[model samples]
Target: MGYGITLQVSGDYALFTRPEMKGERVSYDVMTPSAARGILEAILWKPAIKWIVDRITVLNRIDFESIRRNEVGSKIPPRNVTAAMGGAHVDLHQYPSEDRQQRASLVLRNVAYLIDAHFEMNPSKVGETDTPEKFYNMFLRRARQGQCFHNPYLGCREFAARFQLIDHTEQRLASHYADIEEMDLGWMLWDIEYGEERGKGKTMYSFQPKFYRTMMRNGVIEVSREVGL
Candidate 1:
């Protein structure tokens, strides 16, 4: 059996950008499995351990709000930066006034979730000193002490998230959707399967996006290896 931990995360605003909407930003009804894993990794992560999200519990009612914000239209080309670093003159600076564009976003407000997750030893990264129990204890210590490599955010970096450990023996806090029996979330982005590089020092890597049909029953989304996109 794998060791697991429960983290209670809450944020003021969240934008889980929907892939279909290219122009404007739209958020999913709930947190995706990948986002849950990200939060756990932020709290405590090591190359030897890979986080697996077991389930997510929605603790707040889904509320959406729209707002307009200025964003950059495009990013600076990497080639231009590389050339400039090599003493080749290239215009790499992008003035916000010229690139700024206003866009509306439909985002979730006052969101909270309880993420249940576990860690598995990465076969390639594991060493003689690495053990599941050792990493598990380290995660617990860091989480309880409010320590992290970086502050975890809710979908977007601008929206900060706060997290705490949940005790299993204690009664779980009630969810706003407790009265609702169930709901279908349609097809949602599951996670990106990153293609591994075969040779050393090779810059060949592929990112394949995956999706899954999500159904929430009594405010919980269960994730298992058997459930595939």
Candidate 2:
């Protein structure tokens, strides 16, 4: 375990698209662990350190709303992009007009969550000067000053999130459904696990998503980092 921190995130809308659902987007009942990790990385991230979500606390009532959104159906191929970068003549652009489609999505509305997470140092990537405290302080400073590499979003880029670092020494806010004894949330996305290097320099890896059974007790979901298929 490394240094840990808590973040209070809120947004008007969030769309954590389910992996099984295609064409139409349907969000999960609550924020996903992967999304929470993304939010933390948006604030401060380094190759030497990796973020981990311990748990998440629902601060608002779970609610959903339906909306149709315009999205591009096709993306430029990676080969085309690489060829263009190498000065080869290649079509490396997406024609939104040709691929635009409106898809119905069920998304969360007026969402708020408290993310409890920590980061662990990657030995191979860590530098001589890199220390756990250094990264921890860096995250704290960036978070306190409202600085991020990019705008931290809830589940999607459009749904920008507002974040506040919960100073561990200060009083914490209460969960909205604290009165409830328990609630079953079923399976939820944890994060992605990448396979070992497929080539020299370890430049390429395979992507695989992991999910875990989740149960929310008193609006708080305790995540077991151990997740699998």
Candidate 3:
């Protein structure tokens, strides 16, 4: 366990796209744990520390809205990009007029959540001067001052998120959906686990996406350590 903090995040629209729906975009009812960690990292992150989401509190009703967005059908191939970078005269540009396609998306609207999380020091990346307390205090200061390395978004870059540190002393009321005792969120995407191995004096990295059966009780989703993150 490390120092813990609460952050309140709100956005007009959010799209935590479900992998099952390949063609159309459909968002989850609440923010994903990985997304919450990304928001915290955006505010303040260092290689020595990694954010762990303990729980999330939904502060607003989940509502979905349908919209159509213009998107490109395909992306420039890596081979073409490499050739262009090497001055081999390859066209790596994607013109909207030729590749434009409108896709329907079911996204969440007027969303707000309280993220309860903490940072754990990575011993492999920590230095002699790097301390958990130092990074924790730095995170608090930066979050309170409204500073972030980049603009934080709610799942999608276009749906910008606004965040603020929650004051523990301030009395706050429960959300409208707080009365609901329990709700099953089905299998939800947890996070991608990166594994690195060294063989033949070379290092190889692999990414594996993980999913867990998620449930919310009294408006709070408690992430379990037993899941092996």
Candidate 4:
């Protein structure tokens, strides 16, 4: 058996950057499954369980807004930190004045979504006393109280999201696109998978991003469980 939750998430701005648009940040037409899972983890995350987003309901009409800002182009290299950790003095400071670049972003505005998701316990990680009901109750209590490990963001950290846990029996409000039929969303990022057998006794440091072609049916998107590239 699986325990699921329905949460209402809203934000003033969101930037779910498209992978193809390297120069400028361009958002997808709707929220992606991975982003929905991130919001759930922000509320309550446990290594013993994995969250699966089942569906996403777009509550408000999709709106796009463009903006430009000064941003850092790159981050400090990890090798520099490694050298500093070994007692060698290294310059690890980032100079915003030097790295700052003007960037444009196409973002979503006044976005709201209802995310329905469930969690599955990992047999290898779950303790003997850990039960589905235990975790379900924990999330239920914390979410209802508006408690989260960190403030959930829409996509970028700058745009914070506000959430409310809806009772399972409560009537869900109709979506803004309820009257509309299906709309193709093209290929969207599903999630990233990390695990590759390198050589003997070597750590898996590489990852692969997965994607899928999907559509929104009357403002709702059903997340697929099938695994593929």
Candidate 4: segments with Cα more than 4 A from true spot: 85-87, 196-201
**Segments in model 3 whose C-alpha atoms lie over 4 Å from true places:** 80-91, 198-204
Instruction: TM-score for candidate 4, please give it.
Output: 0.94
Across 128-206, the per-residue lDDT of candidate 1 in tens digits comes to: 9888889999998999999999999889888889999987886788777777788899888889999877677556779
By lDDT, the better pick of 3 and 4 is 4
Winner on lDDT (1 vs 4)? 4
lDDT of 4 by residue, 116-226 (tens): 999999989999899999999999999999999999998899999999999979999899989889988899999998876768865457788999887789989999888
Candidate 4's displacement at residue 60, Å, is 0.7
Better of 1 and 4 by TM-score: 4
| Collision count for each candidate, in order | 0, 0, 0, 0
Model 3, CA-based lDDT: 0.90
**Candidate 1: stretches off by over 4 Å:** 81-92, 197-202, 226-228
TM-score of model 2 relative to the true fold? 0.93
Question: Over the full model, what C-alpha lDDT does candidate 1 score relative to the true structure?
Answer: 0.88
State each model's CA lDDT, in order: 0.88, 0.91, 0.90, 0.92
lDDT by residue for model 2 over 1-229, one digit each (tens)? Answer: 8899999999999999888999799999999999999999999989999998998999999999999999998778887887898899987768899999989999999999999999999999999999999999999999999999999997889999999999989887889889999998888788888886656644675888888988999989998977756
> Who is ahead in lDDT, 2 or 3?
2
Model 3's number of clashes is: 0
